[model samples]
Target: MVHIVVLGAGIGGIPMAYEMKDLLGPDDRITVVSNTDHFHFVPSNPWVAVGWRTRDDIMVPLAEPFARKGIAFKSVGCRRVLPQENALDLNDGSRLTYDYLVVATGPELAFDEIEGFAPQSNTISICHVDHAVEAAKRWEEFCRNPGPLIVGAVQGASCFGPAYEFAMIADADLRRRKIRHKVPITFVTSEPYIGHLGLGGVGDTKGLLESAMRERHIKWITNARTDRFEPNAVHATEIGDDGQEKAHHVVESRLTMMLPAFRGIRALQGVEGLVNPRGFVLADKHQRNPTHRNVFGIGVCIAIPPVEKTPVPVGVPKTGYMIETMVTATAHNIRALLDGKEPAEEPTWNALCLADFGDTGVAFVAMPQIPPRNVNWSSHGRWVHLAKVGFERYFLRKVRKGISEPVYERYALKLLGVKRVQEQTRETTNV
Candidate 1:
């Protein structure tokens, strides 16, 4: 009997397990390993930080759900990976051997890279649900003493959407609290432009996001290199298109929230040829590591290069839809492998997102996420906000039942005309 192990029970792993179970033979076994027992909805983290959501709202216990689905769960976490031995050393000094492995462990927040950059420092974070809860507490205090605000992704940060969402959401929340005039907000980012989002600006994201910030009276500093943070100020340098420093600014604030750079978790670090310098798993189009064919990678743990070089580093975001596409392709490839066939599947890596503000939002679709794509579109509306809320509940239901690609997901995608995987490879052969 085949024993497949999935690492990390976040957005990617739980769904991956369900799809794997449905695709694999009945005799095969599936076990999920995570450091925590509850699965947190990462996308709603910005909302949680602003006091719109709580820890209970986004968390679902994993053990009970896995038991109901005939899957196994372990929360001891990983000490290190022994790829050659096909085994993992757990933090509790136990070991798990697997016939095949999927590395879906998400990125580690690099808070120490910059001095005074994390929650314990001069800033608050919303990257994780716990951090968001802390941010909410600090937010209440910040509201009482409203002042200038700085929000953005620091240099080497890939996930810029949440930074934008949090900034706008915080602005809206402040306005609702009748403290907008008292707090001056500044948007600073490593991306060369407002909506580059590490993919060279998806559709009209550049125009729409910049417009939204302007409308909110939020000033910005693009191509920014955040030097460090002080008690009440953020010091950074803005770079020009020619790769030179354009200006320097020292923005003062009562509260600051800046996204941190992402690196690989300690478990997968130092595995030669298996991961990049940043510790992201290296995989082929089929999501299988070239050095270790039995291993697969998905989500933020996978290595993706920058779309283009900028004055400061900016990595591409592995958004929800894109990660789902990766999960689908990995499932198909693993199933094919079990059938003694070569892997031939490749994910579309499409970028679909809803950047929610307090009461309005921006939605975008970039098919085949890289540049020169087939379909590219973006729009803004209050309906996007409602849709985002509905998505949270629908996704929670999926986790509770361990139902991947549920009927509603399929029918909804069909109704909206969204393709999940690459139907045709770039290769052309003459018949």
Candidate 2:
């Protein structure tokens, strides 16, 4: 019997394991390997950081759910991926071999790239649940002593949504506390322009977000290279179009939170032919590794080229919708391999996103995440915030029930004429 091993248990990995299980043979074994036994709803981490959500509200134990589905589960974590041996070396001196391996392990936050950054240092983060808890405490301390606030993503950072969300959420929270007047806010980013979001600004996102930030009285600095974070200052350089540092200054704040660059997890690094220099998996359009035929990749762990070059480094984001499509396509491709057929399915990589600013929010849809797309649109409303909340609840329920794709989710996207995965080959489409 073939054994399919799925690494990581975050958003992409969990759903990937569920979908692949459904497509595999009854006799085939599926094991989910994750560093943590609990699956945390990451999108809610910012809320957690701001006291809106607790650990129990968004986190779910994976053991019970996987056992119910007759799938094996491991949370001890992995030390390294020995692709040559086709085995995963565990952190506890054990190894698990797999006939087919699915690398869904999410990103390893590159906090070390910057000096005096991260929660333990001058800035705070909401990338992980534990980090959010720590950030929550910091948030309380900052609230007690209101002052200047600096919020944005640093260089090489891809996930810009959370940064934007945190800035607004923090703004809303401070306002609710009646301390908005005391806390001046500034957003700094590696993007050449505000709202670029690594997709070169989605459908006038530049204009929409800039307008929103202005309305909120939030100042911004783009093309910023954050050099270091002192006790109450962010030393950064602003690069002009000529590729020279236009200015150097210290942006001071009592509180700071910047999304750092993301790199591949340590385990996947140094695995030639499996991952790129950044430790991100290199997969073809089929989501399968060219050299390692039996291996596939999904989520932030996969390498996606930057939308375009900027004065400072900025990686393109792999949003929730895009990740889900990758998972769907990977599962189908593996099933095809099991059937002794070449992989044919390709994920649409559609970009459907909701950026909530507490009470109000922005939503966007890209039929194909890449440019020259069929559908490209963006709008903002309070309804977007409500929709984001609904999504959190719906997604958590799906994870708890181990549902791969709920009926409502499928029908809803179908109504919008968006697909989870494109079934036809590019050649067929060309014909």
Candidate 3:
């Protein structure tokens, strides 16, 4: 029996485990290690921060799902990865050896990079369920004493969807509470334009996003780099089109929620040739560590270079569909390796994200996840909002029932109309 160890149990890790089990036989042993035992549907965290969703609504126990699949689950955090020995050192002073290892620990929130930016400061974050709950409390207090509000992403941050969603939700919440006029809401970002979204503009996204903000009366500061945060205001260095920097407005705000930049898992530090300087594991197209073939990585923890350098610098965004693609590829490759066959290379990931506006939503699908894509499509409508909600409901039910499906394949075929094209080609060639 082969021993396979998977680290972390977030959006990336859990699904990868299921895929691996499906490929490997029942006799193989699989273990999942994670710091937390609960998996939070992170996309809905913005709604939780605005009190639209509760902690319980977004969280699900991992033990039940893993148990249903007959996989071993460990709730201990990984302290170090001894890839040379194919062993993992746990925080509890225990070690486990494996034939194959998967690192899906995801990114860490580097809140300490900014001054006066402690988690319990005047600002808040919705990256986790606990943080969202705490932020919701502060939001409620701010509603009673209306003041300026700021929401945006810091420099080098790739996950921009949450920032947009949070800003819109806050705006909606303020209006519902009859305090929209009193609170001045500002959307600040490192992106050069309103809808760059870390992948540059996605087909008319700039105009559409700007229009949405205008309708909501939300002010914006683009090409801005956050320097520090005080209790009442945030200071940023704003760059102009001429490549000159000037002191921007230090807008006063009663509430602020900024998404900090991401970094690799701390456990991966000092692992020679395995991780890049930024701490993300360096993997080939198949998600296997180039230096250590037995070790693999997926999700935000994997290192992917920036498409191009922006004024503020930006990284690639790893959406749910992208992560699942990596997971699927890794699972198949691992199974092949165990069978003494050469593993197949995984394809590069594309990004598909749906940003929820208060009144509606914006949907985008980018091929190759960066610039120079074949199909970069996006649109905004209330139907997108309803579709997002429906997906969330369907996903939760599937997880509860311990069902595993390739979500990316379904979306890719749907969005690109690939099946329709294939059918048309078949008919034409036959005729």
Candidate 4:
């Protein structure tokens, strides 16, 4: 029997385990290890921070679901990965060996990178349930005393969607409280343009996002580098084409929410040849580590080279659909390797993002997940909000039931019209 060990139980890891169980026979062994037993619905974190949702509404335990699928689940944190020996060192001093290993621990927020910005400093984050809860408390306090608001992503940050969502939601919350005018909101980002989004502006993203910000009266500072954060202000710098720079206005923010840059988890850090300089595991097109065939990585834990350069640095964005595609491909390849059959390489992921903008939401699909795409579309309406709510309920149910449905692939191909586009592209190229 082939023994497989998966690290982390986040969105990427849970789906990978279910898919693996479905593909492999009952005789095969699968183990999932993580520090926490509950899996948090990260996309709803913005709503949680705004007090629209609670922790219980967004978290589900992993033990019951894994047990139902016949997979061994451990709540021990990973201390280190000895890939050379095909073993994992746990926090409890026990080493688990495996025929194959999957790393999906996700990204760590580097809050310490900026001055006066630690976990519980002048700023707040909605990256996790605990953080979101704390942020909600701070937000309530801010509501009582409405003032300037600073919300956005910093340099080298890939997850821009949440920043946009949080800003919009905050605006809506203030309006509901009849304090919208009292609170001056500023959308500050490191992107060269308003809608760069770390993908160099998906089709019409620049126009659409800019219009949304304008309509909301949300001021913006583009190509901005946040130097640090004081107690009630954010210090930044903006550069121009002439190689000249100007000191950015110190926006007095009573409440600030900034998404920090991401790095790989500590367990896989410093593993020679296995991870890149940023500590993210480096995998081939098949999601298998180039140096160790038995090792695989998916989702934010994996290293992806930047698609292009911007005035300020940018990293690849890992959307939910993109992560699911990588998980599916990794499971299939791992199964083939265990069976001693040649593995089929998986194609690059296309991104599909549905960002909720309070009263309504915007949906976008980008082929190849970067600029210069073949198909891209965006729309905003109340139905988009309804669709988002339905997705949340359905996803939670699926996770709780341990259902290994191929909902991701079908959703991707259907929504993006990839199959038809690929067929046309092929025919055109051949002619």
Residue by residue across 184-219, what tens digits does model 4's lDDT show?
Answer: 899888888887788877767788888889989999
**Model 2, TM vs. native:** 0.95
lDDT of each: 0.89, 0.88, 0.84, 0.84
Decoy 3 TM-score against native: 0.94
State every prediction's TM-score relative to the real structure. 0.95, 0.95, 0.94, 0.95
The deviation in Å at residue 70 for candidate 4 is 0.4
- List of clashing residue pairs for candidate 4: none
Against the hidden true structure, what lDDT does model 3 obtain? 0.84
Please state the error at residue 370 of candidate 3 in Å. 1.8
**Looking at model 1, how many pairs of residues clash?**
0
Per-model C-alpha RMSD: 3.2, 3.3, 2.5, 2.1
- When summed lDDT is taken over every stretch of 10 residues in candidate 3, the lowest stretch is 412-421
Q: Is candidate 2 or candidate 3 better by lDDT?
A: 2
